[model samples]
Target: MAEKVTAYRFDRIDETLSQLNREDCAIIAGGTDVMVLHKSRRGVPPKFSKPIVFIDHLSELKQVYQTDKDLHIGACCTYTELLEHPLIPTPIKSAIKTIAAPAIRNRGTVGGNICNASPAGDMLPLLYVYNAKVLLRSVNGDRFVAISDFIQGPRRIQRLHNEIVTEIILPSVLEEGTHVIFEKVGNRNADAIAKVSFAGFMRINKERIEDIRFAFGAVGPTMIRSREIEKKLVGKTLPLADAEIDTIVAEFDKIIRPIDDQRSTAVYRKTVALNLLRYFLSLKQ
Candidate 1:
């Protein structure tokens, strides 16, 4: 029979890092994902190691605030907390509602989702649209990493062994005349992983476009911000008399590289991505 597991909790990152660097430790946040892994025996549980660090109790990283210029979301905040926060961006709030079941949302955290770096992670596309920055801390020091750079590949990140994400920072909100949209094609209407997700926001200047952001998820190794697509849309009115909507759709098709998977086929994801882009453009009307 297996021996009972042991666990440790800390109120700080430095103290936890010191413990982790010396012994095998499983990082536990919301435990939504980790619990499943543990039940499945996928990894060594905390009890199996000499010491395990529980970071969910670090109150220093539990702050959720917004300044006139930016929104600061603590890494320890749960999805339900984000959904209930009054200052959260409307687009983000809406997206969080569709993330998972109520039970999962109640226990799942934004930091864990981001750190997991899953391509189908529900909030990642929203983070990309806002150009979110991740704050990471370790025993050595602190540093900030952009979400685009923090995620390296499928279920991977650039996080160091001792580093823990402290918070996510979003730039100040945009003014009026800026439209935002997030659309995803999932298997079911509720609690479904995105087959292909697209998120975009743009500032329209009279008949022209000033700034635009586009992000696609579950289509590549990571949720990607399409600078190429944004560059093409900037300074130009979409669905213009000169540029047809079909042309913009075609451009998006070329920008994303999707693969055939169990949930969806490459051809279908590409087609859905184009349709989602068109739907976003229509919202500007």
Candidate 2:
């Protein structure tokens, strides 16, 4: 008879990460992606070997804080937690709460969503639009990486195996007329991954746009912040003629590149993204 592999849980991040660094153990969070990968024998080790270190109990990673200057969300804050956090701005809370179902949202950590490095990850586009930062730590020390630069490609990242993501930092977005919006185009809007998703930030000054930030996900190799499109919208006021809106729409089309995948066709994704852009721009409520 073969020996059965047992799972382990870590109560402290520093202690567990240090041990895992020495032993090269497998890390598990929600076990959403890990279990599937193991079952399929795709990339992860089988259940019979490598010790599994679960970090779900790290209380330090489950907090959300807001100061006059910034918002700090601990790495293990689950989607359900974020949805309920009083400091998470309304639009962001609304967007993330709708991801998958209640059960998955309850278990999926925001850090896992990021460290997993999936382009289609629901929380990523929102992170990009908010100018979030990822805090990483290892036995060596701590470092911060911009969310925009953290994810390198589909299922790839710059995160070293020895490093653990400790926190996510978001600057305060509390302001009058600070319009933030998120859009996702999916087949059924039920357990559907984003065929294409976008998030935008706008601050209105008088009758004009003061600042703008735009981002898109599930359409490229990684979630992207489109500074070029954002630049075009900044200082541009609404109630403009049809021609100006048309020009802006054309510019948006140039920034996003959608590809065909199991969930949707390339053409459909592109068209839907453009339509959503128009819809978001036209909204006042």
Candidate 3:
């Protein structure tokens, strides 16, 4: 026999939080990930120990607004929503377009992606490099956490039972002339999970490297980034020598730890990742 699951639906954020405070509850926004994650076999209900609060329809969780310093994206906003919104950065749109086909994009929310915390999650590498922040809300109040700190490892996150990630904050401006490269090595062009992915941002001013950032996914426990290595490239003039590129790639090679998974092998992922890094650095020449 299946135990009955209690599901709560609210039209307002405050009401949702009020209900959430009475007991530990799981939040469902864009239930796409949750449904698949908790799917059961042959019509049998998967065991769910926590009550569920459905906030997908709440307006509070579907907004996109910008302040002087940041672009605020409601956690429930779907990939399609962000794609259509003009304020979304090019890098974000580039990454979102690579996600599953239209059906999944229409239903999948970035917030769900953040909470899932998969190493291959398409949004993670971009978010990590963007210096994005995740906002978690509860009856107590609101809290913001750096994306890197919020996502510890595969399927691991820092959310409390009472907290729901309500919004994502992104910087309002990307420096002009920034070159962004986002590549996903997948089996197919569309609707394929990334075997390995890389997102690199570089800005060159008068042939001098003004800023550079590299983040790799599916190659580490969390989105992998090294501030130390990025600092080494700052102010270095472009048309870098082969030896310079090799040195940077070698440094990244040491940190790009991958594992053999059903989707891909460790060696393949590592090789593709380094290749992508080399390609990103080869942009100017």
lDDT of 2: 0.79
Question: TM-score winner among the candidates?
Answer: 3
Cα RMSD of all models vs. native, in order, equals 2.8, 2.8, 1.5
**TM-scores for all predictions:** 0.89, 0.90, 0.95
**Per model, how many backbone clashes are there?**
2, 0, 0
Looking at candidate 3, the ten consecutive residues that score lowest on lDDT are 171-180
Runs off by more than 4 Å, candidate 3: none
TM-score of 3: 0.95
Report the C-alpha displacement of residue 229, candidate 3, in angstroms.
Answer: 0.8
Off by over 4 Å in 2: 1-7, 41-50
The lDDT for every candidate, in the order shown, is 0.80, 0.79, 0.87
Ten residues in a row with the worst lDDT in model 2?
Answer: 40-49
Q: Which lDDT tens digits does candidate 1 get at residues 1-285?
A: 456766778766678878766666667889776666456354644232444568887887678888887899999898888888888878788787777888888888889889888888888888988889998887778899999999999878888777888899998676567777788789887778899998888888786888888788998889867687678778876545425666767777777789999999988988888778777776644
Better of 1 and 2 by TM-score: 2
Candidate 3 per-residue lDDT over residues 53-168, each given as its tens digit: 88878888889988986989999899999999988887779878888889988988889889988898988888877778999999999999999999998889999877889999
> Residue 129 lDDT in model 2?
80
User: What's the residue-level lDDT of 180 in candidate 2?
Assistant: 85
Candidate 2: count the clashes: 0
